[model samples]
Target: MPKTQCTDGVVGAILASWRYDISGISPEMRRDYEQHLAECARCSARQRFHRSLDGALAVLTSLSALFFLFALSVLKHIKPLEHMAFKILGLDIYDMYHMLISAGVAGLCFSLIALALVLMATPAPSYLSGIAVERARLIEARLPERIRSIRLR
Candidate 1:
């Protein structure tokens, strides 16, 4: 497929330098870029791709943290892990357990830090929240009139 070009080269170049993220800009500054994005197919698609990438980073870091937490919980509660460490691996159970616990805790901390960085440095939070708001509006629009009236009250 042929590559699509931006309708306005100057604004598109500016947006590209910012990775098409206009969320950090003041409203007055954002208006022109927003308008360009709305009008330009290429830039709009690029913006969408960048936002989705940010959202994916946030989700992966979150899942990594959760998995690390789950690993720590399993190590703490599962007796078989202790047995495997002692009998199968021929390792000191207490030492092995502590080592595994330390690794899990470190991994959890690292992932949490990554998640915090992603949330702070990208437009993921606002983009995801906008998606949620859109979804909520769509769902609310579809609700029965009686339920909608009840919700309003």
Candidate 2:
């Protein structure tokens, strides 16, 4: 497929330097970039791709943290792991259990930090919230008139 180019090179360069994120810019400065994005299909697609990447990173980090936490919980409650450590591996149960617990805790901490960094450094929060708001509006529009009236009240 042929590649599309940005309609405005100067504004496109600026947006590219900022990874197409205008959320951190002042409203006055953002207006021009926003207009460029709206008018240029190439830039708009690039912006969407960058935001989707940010959102994917946030989700992956979150899931990593949750999985680590789940691992810790399983280690704490399950006796089979202890038995496996002792019988199958021929290792000291207490030492192996402590090591696994420590690893799980460390992984959970690392993933949480990664998630925090992603949320802080990217426009993922605003982008995701915008999506949620749009979805809410669509759902509300589809609601029965009686329910909508009651909600308004």
Best by TM-score: 2
Write candidate 1's Cα lDDT for 114-133 as tens digits: 99999999999999899999
TM-score of candidate 2 on Cα atoms, chains taken together: 0.93
**Model 2 C-alpha lDDT versus the unseen true structure:** 0.91
Error of 2 at 105 (Å): 0.5
Estimate the TM-score for candidate 1: 0.92
Please identify model 2 stretches exceeding 4 Å from their true place. 80-85
Candidate 2 residue lDDT tens string, 1-153 = 118988999999999999999999899998999999999999999999999999899999999999999999998889954475479768877778899999999999999999999999999999888889999999999999999999998
Q: List the residue pairs that clash in candidate 1.
A: none
